[model samples]
Target: MLRHLIARFVFLLAAICAPVLATPAMAATDVSTPWTDEDFASLRLISAQTQTGSSDTLRLGLEFELQPEWKIYWRSAGDAGFPPQLDWTGSQNVGDANILWPAPHRFSIFGLETFGYKNHVILPIDVAIPDRTQSVAINLDVDYLVCSDICIPAAATFALDIPANGNPDTSTSGASTVSTHAHEIEKFVSKVPLTGDNLPIQVSNVFATKDGDATQLHLSVDGLSNAGVTVDDILVESPLRIGFGAPVAVNKDGESNNRHFTVPVFGLNADQDLASETVTVTVIAGPLAIEQSRTVANGPTDASAQGEPLGADTMAPATGAGANIWLIGLFALFGGLILNVMPCVLPVLSIKVMSAINARDGEISRVRSGFLASAAGIITSFWLIAAVLIAIKLAGGSIGWGIQFQQPLFLTVMTIILALFALNMWGLFEINGSDNLGTAANDVINQQEKGGRHLSSHFMTGMFATLLATPCSAPFLGTAVGFALAGSSFDIIWIFTLLGVGLATPYLAIALQPRLAHALPKPGRWMSVVKAVLGLALVGTAIWLLSILAVQIGLGGAIAVGVGLVLGAVFVWARKRSQNLRPRFVFTALAVTGFLVALFAPGFSKPPAPSSVSTAATGPLDWQTFAPETIPALIADGKTVFVDVTAEWCVSCQVNKKLVLETAELAEFFANDDIILMQADWTRPDPEIADYLASYGRYGIPFNAVFGPNAPKGVLLSELLSRDAVLDAIKDARSTAGLASN
Candidate 1:
């Protein structure tokens, strides 16, 4: 019995030791295939004999040892070359496999750029095991392209097997199995780009502009300067079929702590629009690198353009030429006086006329008080605008006239305000002192004379008038605003103050000579007819605002908002018609609710689908959507280009388009095959269009520029367009093109 027990124990021990002795031999046997072309690179598959922790997942690596001067492509191969691909269809017990890519270097060949690794690279592969009890076998068929003077395609098949239960340390028998390459794996693992939540570097602003046939992108990197790092190069990756050139550093006058880089983008498909596309920019500084993605806009925002002000250098030429500051002020004054006749301001000006008419029979002192208050309000509003422009300039941002119209929130709020004003004018409800001049004068005469609210009401009317005048750029107003915005903070304040004084001159004159009001007819039923007519004008303005909103939100959303306004107006009328206070209060509450619904309904809807008319077809004379690169290409092809930078909010732009550019004669002249007409609609905020406008040292709209072979830089037109001016510009451009050709 003793002998039998000893023999049984020995048999059990041998059975366990037998597998352990053979495990080393399995681990030592190479599972990697020989390199097909060792002169370029050597490929292999490596894995660990023992699994780490309690996880059923195994870590493997696709290792490549590249020879000197040979390289492999990254996931985004800048201008050319294909990234490495792996096929694992011939594997077993592998649930999924993912290859991790490391940060790559930018290689510039001639003018073309590429991103890849030049030295030995190891792509760590994570293999998932569905059943840990069963052994895992991985068979990888790799296809990769290596390049030097030329690119060469290479392929190889690698097989790796992991044992279910293997002791890595004690495996002495050289069995064919997995072994640890943890040191090599960990070295390259650190090279992989950091992801998931915390990133070291941040990209603050990215702006793109058209540079001839290429796109110039400016990237502002934050914290790079504080860290004492220099950006060696940058790589831009886009889904569109475009190519990128090498990145160059941009130096600004007063900004040193911030790093700015400009990279040239090439090969943009003329048939596609870049407004909705996104680009990923990777900045590689010494010992540090960061990758960020941003949507491609026309140009950078005020925050992005802070370090570099728009038209700063261009304005230098004007200042150096001894431009008269007083002359500019006089021009601003004339522009402000003429602003009263502009279509956009005419509706609001009707309120001022009503004030004068209502004050005809009132006390002379009261008339003087109301007109003076209105003048004060205009000047104060202008000062406020000046303050905002100065503040933006101090912060290193670009400032343009009527930039508030670029904001969708501003547009939406203004629309609602105009609608409510129209409703009040139509007698749906009456604000205490806002109904008309007669009501306001009565409130002033009957209420506390010292603390009357009518003065503030009249003042607000003046402010509102100034606000309405912003979207229309008058002749002298454009030049004055451009010069003021481009000048120092003090200059901005001074010029704007003059502009306000000019706008308020009419009211001030009436206030000084109270007899002006005495000449007007007395307040009677006729005044009601005049008020109704002005109310209709306000309603027309409201409708135009809705049309602008339709471009951003959608036609459906705009219609919903219009319906809500009508419903709210109905409830307001019900409130006024109610016989009892309780019924009236209930109707008022319902009206408020309806108004709230209308105000927010557009936020819930998706943006409208872009019109097919803008994207359908292309012809030389067919008005193509404005793109920066389009101008240079057209000029290069020996064609004359006419660019119209207009917006729906710009009343002046509409008038010019209808009366001059779209006329039969003008259209026929532009119909020539060698003439290209491009329209850059600025109904919404477009940074690229802003930048293009800045390049000409002009900020106001209804801007036209003609580019031909001779005037390759471009010849700018005035804020107001005329038939003669358009024809003369076209003729000059053609003459210049002919001269250049000769």
Candidate 2:
């Protein structure tokens, strides 16, 4: 488990690079400007109109013709520059002025992430003017950073005169030109999609579920080409939801739209849903777009016109009496049995299988004790996990397995444990290392420890092994866990506990039968060799721990962790060297302390905060933080956005990033085109990312989506990534939105 965490950390470090460069031109429409030599310039705001239900919504534009090669910063001016700011405090009869920015380019100047636009750009503003006011005067105060090799700050205080007259000949050619430009930008914005409606994806319904006591959003989408889509493509926004990889393709019902996409509700991974009201969906299908705001009413409430229920058939027996009780128990048992084979427990099992052969001669009572101990271990571990998961779920946390690693303290604990095991295996210290006796004495010690009749140790070992195995859940296990989280609290707890029992049953059966134990080879010197091998396995586990350290502290820290392991070995050696127990105890304590401090040192360092305003090619982008409330606004604006849900430990995510996302080609494409890129990192198992993943019916990494015009909200992408795949997916999504390459 530690090894996987380290790999994920390394992947994230290698994956994230300088921000992708966006060409400001992508966001701006009909960008033209009047410019003079040197650094001076002016931007003009024009009027455009679009009809709503009753009145028309006013669209204003800021057109700037910067000197060639000169640039202006976006809302998030990246590194050292300031973004353009506007003050409409003095405007008359204008209810609101919302600046619409085009996506901005990313520049790594002196190792800084800068967002800006070059040449000419137009910033369109949405204004809600009073219907009574024929024309409203526009006044503005603006500040911006312009760069041409070197950067310079500038501001403009300007006003436009308007006669309190009729809606100023909007049909004229001049007005039409501005309207065209505004509409062009709207093309990009319109892609943020909505929920509901029968799409090519065919969202049959969206439902609220309690999976293992965790709140989840379930979206049933039909028409899957294959079951692989269940393990890929689908993505959810909220981090607090729970999901498997993707919606599992149930055996097709043979209907054209029988494929269902089960996405966990956003912010529902908690024991209780954290949502105040409403659910927003940005459905992106190759270029087809739909963005809608659906109210998240009562728990799994009847489907509204805006959001559909997952499926009426999906409702399990509301009355528990006649439920498929046998099947539920079978699922639990199978889930537990499968967990034993998961990556997290593999090594532990290896040790146990090897150890079990020797314990065959033990007495029935002893064997029983060992089995009970193992059962206890398994139960305890599962309970602990359940408790934490439930706590977080109740708290509205959005995260899944290995979430403990997010805390430096947890990483520190694992580091110390692994180091000790490694040192013991490497022979730096021996368990009862010193016994000034002949070879025969060691054999006697081994026999005594095994206790011919005591089977409890072996059983206990099994349980302990199972407990340690929780980190890496297998595929089916994730599904089971997700199901457990969605159910009632008691049911969640019982299901997990039952899973533990099922996992231990096989071993217990063998322990209970003396005939099974009597069939083993007689104990001898070979036993020492076997112990030595077990020691080696322990060392391997330590190395895995060190790998995780490398990610948190870099390669240098890994070496430090290695040193701590060595120190632990020395302590073990010292304990063996002398009969005095006090010195040994002190050395052991010191070794443990050193390992912990080294593991968490990197977390202490702080990083800069991300800015809200982002400059894109559309003009000036008014960046909005991701939230349940922001969906309505994003849909209304109609901008194509690219959302990345990443983690520090997700290796696949890094591969996709370095191999595809960081390229200049992608950067150029996103910038020149009015696309918004939003990144949500789960470097430390963030609740937010968890919520986001759950929304898509997943509990781990490598989640992605694209929001395009006409389909402006979002479209989930595949889990295993390829640059070409993403590009094609985006292109296809764009095409669905009535957009075609010219």
By TM-score, who's the top model here? 1
lDDT of 2 by residue, 597-693 (tens): 4554545533223223211111122223444324335545544566766544444455566667766777566663445566665444333345455
lDDT of each: 0.69, 0.51
TM-scores for every candidate against the unseen true structure: 0.54, 0.45
Clashes of each: 13, 118
Residue 145, model 2, lDDT = 74
Q: Quote model 1's TM-score.
A: 0.54
lDDT, candidate 1, 1-742, per-residue tens: 1232233234323322332332332222233444545678988877743442234577777788898899999998877899889898878888887777766776766767778887788787787788766777778889999999878999988776666755433322223233335434544655565442234456656777775566677677666657555555667788888777766655566464666666666777666556647888776655456677777776675453434433322111112123467778888898888887877787686677777887898788888888998899788878877876666545433457776665444555566666666766667764222248647656555675444334766676677678767888888888888778766687788889999998999999999998899998877889888888888887788788788778767788878777877787898889778768677778878877877777787678677654523331222336776765657777888888888887778899878877777778887878777788888776655444554675555767878888886567677788888999877777766645454443
